[model samples]
Target: MGNSQRNDGVQLQDERLRGEQLRDEQLQDEQIRLRRPAGIRSLQLGDVKVTYVPDGAIRLTPRGWLPATTDDVWAEHAAYLDETGHLVASVGGLLVEHGDRALLIDAGVGPLSVPAEPGNAVGAIEGGALLASLAEIGRDPGSIEAVAFTHLHMDHLGWAHHPAPGTDGPAFTSADYLISEPEWTHRHLAEEHGTSEEMLAALEPRVRTVNDGDEIFPGVRVMLTPGHTAGHAAYVITGGGRRLIAFGDAMHSPVQIGHPEWWATVDHDTEQSTSFRRGLVEEMSRPDTIGYGMHFADVVFGRAVRGAAGEGARWEPVDA
Candidate 1:
């Protein structure tokens, strides 16, 4: 072969080898992502220990979950979904511990799962691991001083009301179930959105109505973040010179941080939800600010960052 042709051939071979290596790296990355840890994860803010306990998971239908999203939007973010073509939403509680005292936020979806239906936002929902996860973290049900709910949603209050299958009574029976005042006053409205009357009755005795800014637990105060429900709330925990906002249903996934206008189908008021989400995005952007997205799949603890688009910002998971 001519010298020039031989040189060109070698260059082409090198390019092909580089391309193969890049593809292999991409495949390995995808594999690692699919193997992400699913259960309990912990982060420490100075002396406070925060854990995202896994009860189970729900498969969210892209369009059904967020009615505002179109197929085109889903197309642009196909990587977020699992193999089943569903967005895997973690369903559990956040266990916040400070010294000797412990406060459980959002009790998690108990041991019940429903199959998805034709237009359902969730394809399937199942949870029965909160108690076990707590036990794994060396926390007993009774150890929790109080169960502060972010909202009156069934998933958030499940373990509090639903009696364990093999146990005598409901878990956390000894502790008070702290609910937002407006949420408790207008409890009837939540029933339509799948919060059953049975659950309301079960939790009624232990319910304590707290208002916005109420300091129910040490270093934790309620912030009225409505729209997801009548009295949906977010808890702000400050300790060791840092702040972590356990923003409940205010944000279902990190993707919402990039698009505050995408309200959940379950949101009580879309306009109000968007407003709170926008403000939250800004709050999360500040230094020393971390957020706990209650339903964020694997990387539940993340911080919002200024996004490329004007929509707002995006959520970047914090390994700590």
Candidate 2:
């Protein structure tokens, strides 16, 4: 072949390679951008409609993830933990609707992020989109009849106290915020752990205390599973003979489904939390029931099924 022909062929090949490279890069960028911004996961339980909305997420080192646990025990569950041995906890809320009324189980971590300090378990985390996610589902925060907090943690009260930017005020203006009486009385303790006074001030006026076993809503009963917090409560929404437990922070990581005794360091009462966790695991394994793990990243909702003996169990995500 002529030298010019050879050179021309080489130039065409180079151009084609460049084009393919550019296309590949664009595809990668699109994947990163369009990646689900981590919001809501909806499912229906007979007559009840449940949604797991994202506030954001937090990273907790295994050592910090379960304060009193040994590293060897965590090592056994490494697959469930990320590379850094950090557990990812979703920061958001659960929406339950039946008939015309809507109830938000927990307020998501508000639109805010903060770095961690020594001795603090929760690393960098940010969330502030609970209001927007609610709107997407055609439910206004004000339309929610009640804001039921699983515990008095900041992540659960974020947007409830701090409204999203440029928003009129607290989004759930008309909703009565509910918490356990013990949790309300010991609200000051949350501050020692990490909750801010500003958050408490914002929640004070709207916060209403409720006792255990109270029927906060139709078919929704409160089970005070205290340990993570003095007043941590899970809501069991029973309707049409089916139930879904919005088990807030009871077991942050689905990995906890396997290691119920490995309590998060942030637990106000680690021993009690572990005890409640064991009972919870058993209850979660029963039929016609599902669990809502607020901090459980992408798979926010699932069923805890019993596995071979010591292995405890596995999480089967529930999508409807």
Best by lDDT: 1
Write candidate 1's Cα lDDT for 268-291 as tens digits.
Answer: 998999999988988999988999
Candidate 2 residue spans exceeding 4 A from truth? 1-38, 68-75, 83-85, 116-120
Worst 10 residues of 1 by lDDT: 29-38
Clash counts for all predictions: 0, 5
Candidate maximizing TM-score: 1
lDDT of 1 at 245: 96
lDDT of 1 at 194: 82
lDDT for position 6 in model 2: 100
lDDT of 2 by residue, 204-237 (tens): 8888899888999878899888888887888888
Worst 10 residues of 2 by lDDT: 29-38
Give the residue spans of candidate 1 off by over 4 A: 1-37, 309-312
